[model samples]
Target: MTYGHAHAEHYDLVFRSRGKDWPAESARIAALVRDRAPAAATLLDVGCGTGAHLVTFAKTFAAVAGVEPAEAMREIAADRIGAGQVHPGDMRAFDLGRTFDAVTCLGFAIAYMPDTAALDAAVARMAAHLSPGGVLVVEPWWGPEEFIDGYVGGHLVREDGLVISRVTHSVRRDGATHMRIHFVVADADGIRTFHEDETNTLFTDAQYRAAFERAGLAVTRVHDRDAHPGYLVGVKG
Candidate 1:
């Protein structure tokens, strides 16, 4: 994963680069958890890149932990919260030897699983780490039929005497998003460019539910009137 070293340095700056209201969006996500698991006091964010979700979750939950596969991202997350609060492990298989009241797999992280079997493993692992009645919230990538092929996007950011620009070209193929992302960073040290290639699997709503059910969760797929991609909500039984 390119995020392990290079991209991790720029990961925290991305949402800001894209003009996303971090506080607002995190708050909305927190609200969603409160709605589904009103009594949830602990949370674990799988693929907790840069600890963005955990930062907000900390405000609402009594205890918070994050499982991030990328060492660099996990390191920053440790700095954000505490070293002991973050774990270095893959979402497909991780064990903290404890259960959480709520588990969050956001940022379409599940899309990186590559296939349905991998999704099953990840979902089952997450569900196994949930207390009875605990809730799992997953934000997934677009389904095969829903993806818009040849999609292009870009972002620019200026921070701490550095300027960064990123451009991405993506296309849907064979139930995956084949994406090429290029980044240019300029600072006092001069300028440099790097690229990362990613293939995020496009799993449909039914497929998502199937994984949750196989994990012994009661699942429901929800859609809103807004443009925001919806989520799958599952409750451990």
Candidate 2:
């Protein structure tokens, strides 16, 4: 709940530093939603950092809205999808007084919630915002069994004389993976180090199903793609 400006900006710099291969990933996620959603008119993009998914959803859906908590992240998302479309609120408590045909929390955003109680609370919030026969797609965090500790690496991207590098390390703890990212951006302004810490709960597929059920959403089935091992498509019933 404490991630703020610097953390959010560093997050954007870390994942999107490459600015390549994301289109394919975004396209794939959009296609999956189109296939599984009851209708793709209204979508609630929870934790829609920088509007990556919101932009994609807007291209297909008639109405698209995003809920982003971080101010820095919201600014980026607003620039992509327009300021009016993005709501500034926490994923656990944001309410729009309406329902959507589809709700998606991609990029393991749901895992940021500290515990099962927090996860359940957030899911209940999402469930309330979803219309009858709507669909909810969640890309959960990698389970503890899948985490690889002590992984240290960095990637650099160069575009138009601007360079960005993101270095990351991971530590696995009680059913969670805590990651620290170091971002270095080189431009005419020089180089700087921006640090951020993120924690994701490693909830199992069975636990995910149970949480959805407890939230009053019927878990139709889970579609797993080997390319994205931690992704799950749950059609609400």
TM-score each candidate.
0.94, 0.88
Best by lDDT: 1
Off by over 4 Å in 2: 1-22, 220-227
- Model 2 CA RMSD to the hidden true structure, in angstroms: 2.4
| Candidate 2, pairs of clashing residues | none
lDDT of 2 by residue, 97-155 (tens): 99998888887789998888888888888988888777787778777777888778779
**lDDT of candidate 1 over 182-206, digit per residue (tens):** 9998999999999999899989888
Distance from true location, Cα of 236 in model 1, Å? 1.3
- Candidate 1 colliding pairs: none
Q: How many steric clashes between backbone atoms does each model show?
A: 0, 0
lDDT of 2: 0.77
